[model samples]
Target: MIRKNYNSLLITHILDGNFTYVKNGKHTTAHKGDTVILDCYNPHEYYTENGFESIWIHVSGSNSYELFEEIEKSNGTLIKCKDIHYVEKLLFRIYDSIKGDTPPSELRISVDIYKLFAELLNFQTTKSLGENNYEDTVQQIKEYISDHLSENLTVNELAMAAHMSASHFSRIFKQQTGFSPYDYVLIFRLNRAKFLLKNTDLSVSTVAYKTGFNSESNFIYFFTENVGISPGKFRKLKF
Candidate 1:
């Protein structure tokens, strides 16, 4: 069907059958387990030869444009998800929140949308780098960040640890690891939070405190934004 421009990010997850998604003067077929992340600012259309089922979420936020740009640059708008099962769960959770009696707060929605964007980027990074190579400097940077996720980390500080200027270090780091220092730090902290949530019976507050968030609320917010669910919900669903 012809879809008018949306002032938001539009995501479509195909569960069954296939749909043709057109954008930017090009079109692609999205099959079962395929995901299409498109900027609604552009005119787009979806057509199906047969009836199809899909989950769609429209998101708008400060980070939406950047995430959309990143995805477009690296993997274009279509994401053949590496983990469809996990993606399905996230989509269902978003769907539930939208369809619930008490609609979820905007914070909740933004977080879920960011989480989905992160997943797409992570998958693209993984796919673009099929081989594994970790240098000592890269490993050391990761270790330091992981060890001090509870502390405020700055580019200068991380660059100092690597014995390089901030700009130079950032350039090489992104080239080597497929993530900027800032993005890497966030991913590391989020991963650590996930581990703690899965392994410990700690309260959300405690997890937040341990994961470097100044307050429980902040931690929960960041976690929800990155993981697409509250810390409690992630713990329950994952564990």
Candidate 2:
């Protein structure tokens, strides 16, 4: 089949036979147990000489575009699921949900779509680590970040913990986790700050310091920019 410039995302799982997928002048062959994710906003074609069988879905709305872009950036548009059965299960759940007499809830469909994305991401992470022999390095780096949240963290320091150069570590970290090292650190700090603000009576300044920000003003600025509210305001909400 041929398609282009459509405003939705397409995910297809190849259950039988084979097909050639061409996107942006690149050709890929997908066979049984493989999945193809396409941003229909681009010109693409996929067809089989002998025909093929597959389960497919089109997804749009909410954070679908952003999530698909992130996954494609890290893992490409095609993947061979390590657990194709689980992938099929998720697809079936979505299909069944929409086919029921009572219309499915938005949350239910979103959950399944998110799970499919997670499965794709996890597969990519495992594939990257296994192929590159970074078996324990990424996990170690994440643990180090968590353990040292109360202190300043840098790409250089994180690379040292992973025993790789800054550039190389940064590349692998983004590929494996779909986020740069700096963004990862920032997100981790924000999460910790939120937790402390909500769970403890610590002052905003103390929470800021504990999460590795240099000053309360800087932390407040960062939090407000990302979370859309001040730390004190976030804490006041009944979460």
Error of 2 at 127 (Å): 3.6
Predict model 2's lDDT versus the native: 0.83
- Model 1 clash pairs are 1-46, 111-225, 150-212
Error of 1 at 119 (Å): 0.3
TM-score of every candidate? 0.52, 0.54
Residue-by-residue lDDT tens digits, candidate 2, 184-226: 8897788667767876899999999889999999999999999
Candidate RMSDs in order: 18.5, 16.9
lDDT of each: 0.76, 0.83
- Model 1 earns a TM-score of 0.52
Q: Give the 10-residue window scoring lowest on summed lDDT in candidate 1.
A: 127-136
Best by TM-score: 2
Q: What TM-score does candidate 2 get on C-alpha atoms?
A: 0.54
